[model samples]
Target: MKNVMISLAVMGAFGLSMPAMATGLVAIPAAGFTGTAYTLCNTTGNFGSSTPTQPTTGANNTCATFPANEATSPVSGYTLIASTNRNAVIGGITVGAVSDRVWRNTAQTSCIFGARFTASNIDWDTATTGTQYFEVNDIARGGFGSASVNAGYYIQATNASPVYRIGRTFTSVQHRAYKYDTAANKLLLGTNYLDLPTANSVNTALTGEVTGIGPTVVASTTSATQDAIVNSNWIDFTIDVAYVDDDGGSNIVSAMTYVEAACDSSAVSGWVKTGAIRLRQTGQENTTLQEISIDGYAPPGSTVP
Candidate 1:
């Protein structure tokens, strides 16, 4: 919703009032635990190597997803949407760097399969003192591959060794009960056990597991609703992401240009050639500058020429 408004505001500012036929815009809000640096489910913690050891900041050999309200511990009550695919394949969002395997918990005792996490009330993250960054953790896997007490996930100090035991505030965006019957980008993928934060910049490497994305935006029906001037010949598209804070941290972004496709100038190129036209009316073959009216599209201040 906020991203759309920003796009429209840019148009109006430049005298591009929402095209008359521009009925509505779609927005994809990222609602879930983006990532809060938590501790690895380590046993030896010597960057714990595994028969199933979660080294200092790593993941494990299991994956699971759920609907909201299924409890984990510390925090609960989240309806965040997420998804999971088999064998390192993610959906929707762009994929990045990949690794064969990093240190993780494979130990039987430490590898409790079904675990979950939720949000935290603590001020672990602050503009100043910058510290603590892990996305989500499977708390049940804390004491992985055989070792001592399960201590980690929630911590008390800046980068202080992770709180390795239970009965502490762990964090995440959603849990089992929040799962809706239908969703896409809302879902999360990957072992994501004991995730570590990359650099502060938006584009940087972070995790050691395979992650994929589902579709961020919902689908629309063909020839669906449009505004007063629907120019079907060309689809006007605007995409944006939140760059900085707005009314409690939002993703309001600006412009980017289009890239030519790989099929440019080829037979299957998106642009149609003159020979492709099939006019039923006589003398139309030689005529140009014809205005096409798209179904359900009504462009502003535009009359069929």
Candidate 2:
């Protein structure tokens, strides 16, 4: 199995309008891979934060919107393609939405996954007293061996209530990856982890593990402990899976994951990158992943082109 590494970060001052809505944008990386990749940002936290709110019978709980200009970059031998922007809604209300974008290195990519939400408005601190809180969800390739992965992150606010806060609060960075079996509709291997700030200059890490057979894997991991805030607020994460297929033998696994943190600033955080590489099977050569810098800022203007 071969191990490949990918590093990523977001920079610049992007403009964001108020009114409590969800929006998404896509971007293509410099490198390419064999499988397909999709990025989704949902009102739910599965991708990161909580979920959006929705009415039971029929009300406005969800909505959809579009992003401005899409960007693309080429790295290695792959072409990264991004999307303009998109919106996600729950029930009828618009929790928070995202831009639906994807990157494909080849046509042989197989996987149809994205992100979703449960509710639109809920409180995070108290849920009952504080403000409305939301939940996040993720969708991945259904089958194993030849499946693709898709995930997203988003935020939502309470409509009538004025407790919920919108826009970038504290910078929170997270990442996850999974292997699935499309045939039986099962998840083979997966990981869910989160990194957040603690105290003054410390950061904490939280993680969840998935285990079991085809399509019936069970998740049983504790929440991450509170750590110092390494980088205040904004951060980036990436996951890479590299493997080899024999004529009729077992599938070789080579996985590499990375995390990038930006420096603390009243305006934005500076970029800092870190990564880890490992092989699932033995007899394979070990690989080293490179670190990349990231810049964070707000986008200017209301129209995206």
Q: TM-score for every candidate vs. truth?
A: 0.15, 0.24
Per residue, candidate 2 scores C-alpha lDDT tens digits across 70-135 of 223111222323232233332333433333233333431321112221222323224234332222
Model 1 Cα lDDT, one tens digit per residue, 151-230: 21221112212212111111111111011123321222212222222112221111121221222322121111111121
Candidate 2, run of 10 with poorest lDDT: 275-284
Candidate 1: lDDT of 10? 62
Q: In model 2, which runs have C-alpha deviations exceeding 4 angstroms?
A: 1-20, 24-40, 43-68, 71-179, 183-219, 225-291, 294-305
Please list the C-alpha lDDT of all candidates, in the order they appear.
0.18, 0.20
TM-score of 2: 0.24
Error of 2 at 229 (Å): 6.0
